[model samples]
Target: MTGSTEASLRVEVLGSQHDRNSFECGVEPLDRYLRMQAGQDARKNIAAPFVLVMPDGAIAGYYTLSSTAVSVGEWPVETVRKLPRYPLIPATLLGRLAVDRRQQGRGYGRYLLADALLRSLRSEIAAFAVIVNAKDGNARRFYQRESFLPFPDQPMKLFRPMADIAELFR
Candidate 1:
């Protein structure tokens, strides 16, 4: 989609009226989870879900964020040396992110991730990083392009410090 066309997709907090039932993101687990459990997760305060709606109001994609923490032990020694000596460091989890298969290559995923990062930055909670547990190499690579770094000991667990995110947006 062209930038103008892509811009027509609007993102807002998931609501009962959004059509999530038929959304498919190619990944069965992700698509199924969003269709089946996203709302309940939101209602239970477990995570906050946001949906991307096409101009016509059809749901195109979604992502979730929640308060999370990481063990300092998961980081490189040099990285940990720069932090406080706490066992767990505050972080925000990009718990789930998906772009509908129908719209997969239209750049919706990147826009969704950028939205998630900006939302995390605006949050009142003090989070040192935005963390994402990438399910596979492709997902990890996508995040890396957005400047997220992989934990040396855990490549699939990626992070982009809030400072970096702030720089990106500014």
Candidate 2:
């Protein structure tokens, strides 16, 4: 299926033979991590992965969403103080996001992210925030551009309030 826009791309949840092959070709590191998670029986903790395929049927990129828990202490004090003294809150984790080297600079990564956030918004799992551990400066910058705020203690990690993200869909 083609994307709705001119730079048409298809985004689908990962499954099946074709999806596996596309994931391997596009983002082997992410694929390896997913396999490891599956081997460790941690797949139950994660939402399904999704992949973006170009019109030519090549995987352009992929991302995975997962249910996660975060302690109130982990958040900024300003945000934490507003909530009741619960030990932890349910959160959504963007576990892996990668683009094929060949597909880099084509805006497929942005497309993959937009698709991921849209799906997350529709999920039944309760999530007060979306969190990501950015792998590098470039990755960090990408999330920053999308309005994700850096964790005060861990600059490499970033988060977006679910309310802010929801407004984007409006």
Candidate 3:
């Protein structure tokens, strides 16, 4: 499936035990970034994982969203001072995102991310930004192409303010 052909694609969240496993096996990136960190991050309330399933019940892709704390010092001074000192501002971290090899090139990854972002916007999560640590140069490029900005000090990391993402849906 590719391009316009995917207009009718059916994508939904993984909601069952089998679906979770399938989603795990379908994407290594998800496994590395989220599943492996499930114990330490997820259980500790640091992050949450979500999966995208196709109509046939096959796992197409997966992503993780989590609450993160960024120091006011990490942000530009202009943006930092505007925020309260030591504020635990809401943040959504895209811990991992991957499309199955079999489903690659179908734009499923974009769909998966869009779903995650939309959910964040709608939820009362209070996230000020969505952050992603790209696994490699390719992943970094992908996020950058999607309008995420790379941190000056950390090129592999990309971020998009929630307000900026919300504007896209308008």
Candidate 4:
């Protein structure tokens, strides 16, 4: 879909009104999370799940954001060198992101990820970066394409500093 067309789709907090049952991203865990645990996670203030709703009210995609912390050691050495001596750094976790299988290659994944990053950047919480734990190699590549750097020790785990992300929106 074109950027203008995608812009017309609403991105909002997941709620009872959003249909979660039919959302399938070709990933069982992702689909199951939306159908099953997303609501509970939202209610408990664990993670804030957001959904992309089509004009006809179908869910095109979803992502979750929550406060998280990472040990400084988990970062690349260059990243750690620039940080304070704090053992654990505050961050936002882009915990889960999925686009429905039908919407996969239409740029919905990038759209959802951009929305998630913007939300994280605008939050009042003191997060130094946005973190993601990619489920597989494809997922890892997806994040890397968006400039998320992989931790030296954990290739599938990645993050992009809030400052760098801010530059994109600016």
Using Cα atoms with residue i matched to residue i, what is each candidate's TM-score against the true structure?
Answer: 0.96, 0.83, 0.79, 0.97
Cα lDDT listed for each candidate:
0.92, 0.75, 0.71, 0.94
On lDDT, the stronger of 2 and 4 is: 4
Q: On residues 1-170, what C-alpha lDDT tens digit does candidate 3 reach at each position?
A: 55554665555533434244444434465655533554455557666666666657666777777777665556655556667666566678887788867777877888888988888788786877888899888899899889998766778877788889989899
Residues 82-158 of candidate 2: C-alpha lDDT, one tens digit per residue: 77788998888988888877667767777788887878788888898889999888889999999999878998888
Residue 153 error, candidate 2, Å: 0.8
The lDDT, on a scale of 0 to 1, for candidate 3 is 0.71
* Candidate 4 error regions (>4 Å): none
Q: lDDT value for candidate 2?
A: 0.75
Clashes of 1: 0
TM-score of 2: 0.83
Cα lDDT tens digits for candidate 4, 1-170: 88777768989999999999989999999999999999999999999999999888999999999999999888899999899999999999999999999887998888899999999999999999999999999999999999999999899999999999999999
From the highest TM-score down, the ranking of the candidates is 4, 1, 2, 3
Q: Which candidate number would show the highest TM-score if scored against the true structure?
A: 4
**How many clashing residue pairs appear in each of the predictions shown?**
0, 0, 0, 0
Where's the lowest-lDDT run of ten residues in candidate 4? 1-10
Error of 4 at 40 (Å): 0.2
